[model samples]
Target chain A: MDLQTLTYIVVGFTFALYIGIAFWARAGTTGEFYAAGRGVHPVANGMATAADWMSAASFISMAGLIAFNGYGASVFLMGWTGGYVLLALLLAPYLRKFGKFTVPEFIGDRYYSRTARIVAVICLILASVTYVIGQMKGIGVAFSRFLETDYDTGLFIGMGIVFIYAVMGGMKGITYTQIAQYCVLIFAYTVPAVFVSLNITGNPIPQMGIGSTMADGSGTFMLDKLDQVVTDLGFKEYTTQVMGSKLNMFVYTLSLMIGTAGLPHVIIRFFTVPKVKDARSSAGWALVFIAILYTTAPAVGSMARLNLMNTIQTGEVGTVEGNIEIANVPQWMLNWEKTGLLQWEDKNGDGRIQYYNDKNAEFVAKAEAWGWKGNEMTKVDRDIMVLANPEIAKLPNWVIALVVAGGLAAALSTAAGLLLAIASSISHDLLKGVFMPDISEKNELMAGRIAMAGAIGLAGYFGLHPPDFAAGTVAIAFGLAASSIFPVLMMGIFYKKMNRAGAIWGMISGIGVTMLYVFQHKGIMFVPGTSFLGDMGPNWFLGISPNAFGAVGALVNFAVATVVSKVTAPPPDHIQHLVEDIRVPKGAGAASDH
Target chain B: MNKTAEQYWKANIRLVSILLVIWFACSFLFGIILVEPLNTIKIGGVGLGFWFAQNGSIYTFLVLIYVYTKRMNALDVEFDVHED
Candidate 1:
């Protein structure tokens, strides 16, 4: 079968599987709707959590980010993975013991204040909505490229699919579907990686393949060859490039770490598992699964970069034959060109494509002497790296088709997860818990479904006009979560004396300062040209990117909460008992149906 | 709090602090702060420091969490707090 037909078949099969799972797992009660009846096995929950955690950013964009940014992008790898440690050690088990349906429920009960719960709901919505926007856009981009549809049509189709399962299944539906998604995505990710690894290094494993010597018998490491190729064209070395200041990288990594742990979607996954010990061990299993892709990512990134360079720079530098004739360009390049993601100008009236660092002044004289006008490859979207890798490596059509299915699985799974977080915060925390405390369980379930639909609609709308940082937007969500929600969750669990006043003020100031810094730099709600202070380094508070400001915001929260608590009365006795109760593993059962 | 619960909580705190320190050392210290010095050493044809940043720290994190789960479960059992 052709690539397009094969992609349709594979993608069609996966969607059918998801819809089947959704119907089979349709939730019947509020407990099942919100927490999957709190009966998910630890290993099963871990797979679901892994799928929930790795969004389109991880499946589609991260390797591309690493491909171009080189060593500097290690911050993404370390920062994203490191947060599981915090989750596993500090957060997951305790929260599981608390036996709550949503994060705000814990905050309200622990602080003994409904107002604190409302503040938490607001913060969760903000973080989750921002996070969901990226997933929606990712789904659209993946569909448009694979199915040969316009972005808007693809987005609507994506919304329709999510609406079917999310509205019907809730967490129960999402959990099982996410498990299937994890299988599809992981298989798709590693198959291409294994093929590319073997082609480049004669090794089957991606991690070891990257470290192994090149198959050409050149005795040079794969990374060394990549470094030589890019450096020959004036790009930084692949192994040694620093992203920004060392301090900035440190803060950026820290922010992502804590942010990952703090995300409401990820934290709530643990709530579905059977026991407190299961929650603790399930986190380890989730990381183990996530690491399979994380480790393969760097290998795929470096190998894809090598493959791209080899395709364009067919001849040696300073020679006419070094450039590939436009007619001789590989099929993948032409394929991506149809989507307007890859383009070449054929500058200097040359029919050959010159992909080089024309922006580097040092290479200008050499390029001018060679009669090259400028780099002909004017545009290369980084996201195409993973999607195009199989084709570039001359893999079979089925393999290429699998990649498209995998990409869609990643985006849809994460989008559903974030939408669930947003919906639960609205329906459970805001509607039933606070406003309409007299609502029936049946009505609450209905409200949760409505909230899911509304949240998905809003996400799809924002996705149409995605903010400038389409790929990096998740980091901003992480910042908001880390700064605003994480500190409160941590304090609520660890600090018995942290009263309602302190928790409320901490969330407000944490989210307040973090959003202010981001808005001043990135714009209010990320509307372009609206940032009063430009995003340049000089405008930053301490040369930190707006994304890296979360750590500082979190510190502000910790300080303000500590100082406020010093002056405030201690939490009431039952609340203190509640904290003590969550700290142990005894008497923990299936979450109570309030 | 009961004496047993207090001690159990203290043990948990001590364990978390130690594990967090290891976490900090791997990602923040070896991976970033002391990277230059550690890069002088090589591992599997890559710089030790860069490898730590890209690969090693994640592995350590996995191990740390597994160890924590095992140790914490043991602690729960010792304190007669294990779930029924």
Candidate 2:
């Protein structure tokens, strides 16, 4: 069968499976709606969390980022995974023991202040909304490319599927559906990787394949060969190019780590498990599942870069026949060109495609002597490295279809999770907890569903008309979470004396400074032409990118909160006792409504 | 708080501190700060530092969590705080 038909069938089957799971897992009460009745097994919850945490960025864009940036992109790999340690050790067990539904609920009760809860709700909404917009865009792009639908139509279809499952099943529905999604996405991701690995290095495991010698009897290590190829074309060595300065890489990694732990969508998953111990172990299992893909990514990235260079430069550089003729360009290039993500022009009036670092001044004179006008490959979106890898490697059509479904699954699962976080904070935290404490359980559940549907509508609209900062949303979302939410939650659990004033001011100042810094560099709210300081390295504070400033923001939060609490009144007696109780694992009753 | 409860909390804090130190050393120290020096030592086709940045640190994180889980569970039982 043709590729599009196979994609339709496979993607349709996965959608059918998700709807089936949603039907079977329909939640009846507010408890089930919010926390899945706290009955999910540790392993199952871990799988669900993995699916929820690994968004389209992880599945679609991370390898591509690594492929281009090389060693500098290690910040992403380490930063994202390192947060799991913090979640498991410092946060998960204590929060699970608190026995509440939403993250804001814990903050409100712990600090004994309605204002603190509202601040937390604001932080959660800001972070999650920014994160969800990226997923929605990923969904639209995947559908437009694979199903041949327009971007708007693809977004609406995606929004509709999420509305059905999320509104009907709540956390219960999302959890089970995400388990299925994890299976689909992981399988889809690894199958192509394994095939490409064996093809290139005669090894089935991609993790080992990247280190082994090439299979073409070159007798050179894969990384060694890739390093030689790119450097030959005046590009930086593939294995050791730093992204920015070392300080920026360090802070950027730290920001992403804390941000991963702080994201409300990820934190709330632990609440679905039955016990404190389960929460700790579940985080481990989640990382294990996540690691399967994370470790394989670097291999896929290095190998794909090697393959791309080899295909374009069929022979040694500086030779007459080095570049490939336009007519002989691979089918994958032609296929991706239709999507507008990959483009080429016959610059210098030559009918051959020359892909190289034209900007390298040292190589300019040499290239002029070779009759090259400029690089012919004008644009290559980093996302294509993973999305088009299977095609580039000439894998079977079915495998390509699986990749499409996998990308959709990754996007949809995380979007659903983020929407649920936003909805729950509105319904369970804002309306039920603060505004209408006397609201009926049935009414609250209805409110939650309405909020979820509304969120999906808003997300769909943004996806159809993404903002200028859509490319920078990951950094914004992570920065907000790391700066505002993570610090307050840690203090609430670990620092028993942290008063309401401390917590409230900590959140405001932390998020406030982070926003100001990011806006000054990236433009106010990421609008073009509004930035006071240009987004350049020398203009940055301490040479840190706005994305990396979250860790610094977090430090300011810790320092401010500590000083503020010292000057203000300490928490009351019962509040201190509540902190003590959460520290222990005993008497952890079922997650309860008020 | 009771004496045993305080001790259990203290033990938990100590264990977490040790694990966190290891986590920092693997990712930030070997992967970033000391990467240049460690690159002199090769592991297969790649430098030891690059391996840590992309691969080794993630593996260590996995092991650290499992170790913490097992030890913390044992502490819970010893402190009579395990959920029935």
Candidate 3:
């Protein structure tokens, strides 16, 4: 079958599978709606969490970002995974023991203040809404590219899929559907990787292949060969390029770590497990599943970069005949070029595509002597690397179709998870917890579904008309979660004396400073031309980008909360006892409405 | 809090602290701060630092969580606080 038809069939099959699972797992009660009846097995919850956590960014963009950034992108690999340690060790068990439906409920009950819960709700909404917009956009992009449809039609379809599963089955449906999604995405991701690895290094495992010698009898290690090839083209060596100062990378990694732990969507998954011990082990399983993709990603990135360079520089660098002739450009390049993500121009009218680091001033004079005008590949969007990997490697059309399905699965799974988080907070925390304390169980479940539908509508609208800061929304979401939610939750569990006033002020100040810093650098709400202080290194505080400032905000939160609690009254006696109760694992019953 | 419960909490804290230290050393120390010096050492085709940043730390994190889970479960039983 043709590529387009195969993609349609594979994607259609996966959608049918998800809708089927949704029907099989329709939630019947408030407990099922919010916490999947608190009966999910540890391994199953772990798989669901993995699917929920690995968004389109992880599945689609991470490898490409790593390819271009080289060693500097290790921040993402380490930062994203390291947070699970914190989640497993410090947060998950305690939260599971508390047996709450939503994160804000824990905050409100622990601090004995509705205001604290509201602050948490605001933080959760802000982070999750911004995060969901990115997923919605990813869905649109994947649909448009694979289905050969316009972005709007793709987004509407994605929204319809999410609505069918999320509104009907709630967390119960999302959990099972995400398990199926994890299987699809992981299979799609690794199959191409395994093939590419064998082609590149004669090893089937991508992780080991990246560390092995080249398969062409070149007697050179893959990394050594990649470093040599790119450095010869005036790019930095692939193995040791730092992102910025060591301090910046340090803070940036820390920010992402805490942010991952802080994300409400990920945290809520633990609540579905049966026991506190399961919660801890469940996080381990989640990390194991996530690490499978995370480890393979670097290999895919390095090998893809090597393949791309080898294709362009068919011969030695700095030679007249080194570049590929325009007429002989690969079919893959032509295919991607039609998507407008990969473009090339025959600079200097040489009729050859020269892909190199043209901005390297030391290489400029040499390039002139070599009769090169500039780097001919003008717009190689990093997002294209994974989507185009199979085509670039000449893998089967089925593999390519599988990748399209995988990308949609990643995007849809995460979007559903975020929408669920938003819906639960509004229904469980806002409507039932605060506005309608006397709401019937059936009425509350209905409210949760309606809220979920509304969230999907809002997310679809945002996807159709993404904001200017859509590109930067991930960083903002992470920063907000890191600065506000993670610190407060940690204090609530670990520090028995943290009072309402302290928690409230700490959240406001933490998120406040983070917002101020990000807005100053990225523009107020990312309005174009509004970043009064240009987003340059010299203007940054301590040479830290706004994205990396979350850790600092978290530190400030810890400090302010500690000091404020010292001077104010301690938490009430029963609240301190509640903390003690959560610390132990015994008598943890099913997640209750009370 | 009861004495055994206090001890259990203390033990949990101590285990977490030690694991967190290892976590920091693997990712932040070897991966970032000491990356330059560690890059001088090679494992196969990979720099030790690069391997830690991208691969080793993730493996270690997985191991740490499992270890914690086993130890804490044991502690829960010993302290008579384990769920039925």
Candidate 4:
């Protein structure tokens, strides 16, 4: 039961489960393929939606980001999950009543314009592809680290799994698999959280661990202790306001909300349930499920922060210093050492490891005075924490294996959903809605499968050649979705006067501006040589960073749509009747076939 | 039936407004603007604000949803439009 071998078994089993589910739930009709036959139980759909929504970004990177950043990172946990409110109240029910298979379908039909549908399709693809890229990269990373495989080889294996289920299952297949995935991922996330919480604060419930007191009668919260420890090593206080601008934090939170609203996979989940009320209830249930993982994440971060500090910074671990001759490290450290994620240097000629902030000037002076070059801990990949948590805690090898499966589950479940969204948009929205009106259901289903495989290849390519924002890249995609898609969708559902022109214009402007802003910041297509203009302006109108610009884009969407609609003629009565029908579940089953 | 439809729509709007006010207050106001002041208090060793940032607000959202579903279920009954 070696950790690596265990990881393989767990991940392999989950993949089998999904592939099996994919075949069992193989979509028969266009209706099932697109919307799971519009009969997905609310609770079942809720679990699936939760899995679809919580990507690798949620499972791998979030806690590590929170661990390193402290209280400021709380914004992500709150802001991102809070968006279920917008989904539940404003979007889900009406969209379900609209009974459309795709977000662009709603736009095309509602706006009475092909141009608007095309624009919506473009937005969906851009947002979803960017989001999927990160998940693919994450899957590759998880496979390599846990299974001890090469990065490229691991990526291929990961892509193969996604290809199996996503290509076979379509929405109906992916939906059921996603439910299983939700269970795996949540269990994987919470178990370690509980263990870590217990280790640090004597609390098994991670929700309490973030603020719980230390057992040593220290008279201060664990976070305060963590603050003191890191600051003692020249890092900032864990609870202090971000040393960076508060405005950046505000914008980042806003962008994330906009992205949450815009992501296509999540929106599509709402379309699966039977009635508008079910949609509303499904959102609520999804939020409840997501909250289980979200609430525990901060606790995991704080606990890991404290554990890492306790293990590395005090006594023989630090005092002996200077690599500790690489012999004296624990078995877990030695294990991680092989991954190149953990390293040591004996700069001071001392035999131990020095773990402190090398970037801090005073710490550099202190370390130099203490006869060292600087901090020697090199290449701490943020993903190592979630991947290696069971090993770090000296938990069972099976738990470690389960973490691997969980990580893959998280990545593949989301990737499957994204691929389906992309495929449907291409086959149903683009081909059917725009190019070919007379295509048969059989051809369309085959086209959907082909499109899915094509998307998997694109995602696999990104995984092999990852972009710089490695960890936070998916979050950026989330922001794009929030800023661009969510606003236009809200208008379409609730704003009776919003015309097709307004919806079309608003969505294009929202997505386009946000992507342009992101391109400028992350560099044109994330090509390494970024220029001054893209470095998150004072350049970005009022000091808004690129990450937070999604909210601004959404506001622009709302503004443009409102203005355009006000100046336009009213939508035809049939469209208005469509709206009224969407308001309740009276004719929900009838329209559910779309 | 037309009158019932009108009543159903009005009821929906009213419910939305009330729930929306609470939603905005929790997520935007307390979770963001008024967070620092709120953090001064504690619930079970966790900061009131931080708890809201993590768990409290989500809990409230759940409660709000159940409440909405129940009230809407009643509204459906009144309109004779409850989904079977």
Question: Which has the greatest lDDT?
Answer: 1
Fraction of reference contacts reproduced per prediction? 0.74, 0.81, 0.89, 0.46
Off-target runs (Cα >4 Å) in candidate 1 are: A468-470
**Top TM-score model:** 1
RMSD to the native, candidate 4?
2.5
C-alpha lDDT of candidate 2 relative to the true structure: 0.88
lDDT of 1 by residue, A487-521 (tens): 98999999999999999999899989999999998
Candidates sorted on DockQ, descending: 3, 2, 1, 4
Q: What local lDDT does model 2 show for residue A29?
A: 81
Residue range A343-441, candidate 4, lDDT tens digits: 777665566567788888977787676666677676667766777666767777787777778888898888888999999999999988889988999
**What ranges in model 4 sit over 4 Å off?**
A216-220, A241-244, A316-325, A343-349, A468-471, A530-541, A592-594, B1-4
lDDT of 2 by residue, A225-327 (tens): 9898998888898778987789899999999999998999999999999999999999999999999999999988888888888889999798868889999
Measured on C-alpha atoms, candidate 3 has an lDDT of 0.88
In candidate 4, position A522 carries an lDDT of 70
* TM-scores for chain A over all candidates: 0.97, 0.96, 0.96, 0.94
Give DockQ for candidates 1 onward, in order. Answer: 0.83, 0.88, 0.91, 0.53
Comparing 1 and 2 by lDDT, which wins?
1
lDDT of each residue in A1-594, candidate 3, tens digit only? 999899889999998999899899988887877789888999999999999999877888788878887898898899889999999999999999998899999999998999999899998998888788777777776776786666688778888877877788788988999999999999999999999999999999999998999999988999999999998888999988987778998998999899998999999999999999899999999999999999999999998898899899999887868889999998888776765557899878978888889899998778888888898899887767888888888899999999999999998899889988998899889988888999898988888788878878877776665542232456567888999999999999899999998999999899889989987987776565788897889999989988778889899889898999999999999999999999999999987778
For model 4 the TM-score comes to 0.94
Lowest summed lDDT across 10 adjacent residues in model 4 chain B is found at B44-53
- Sequence-dependent TM-score of model 1: 0.98
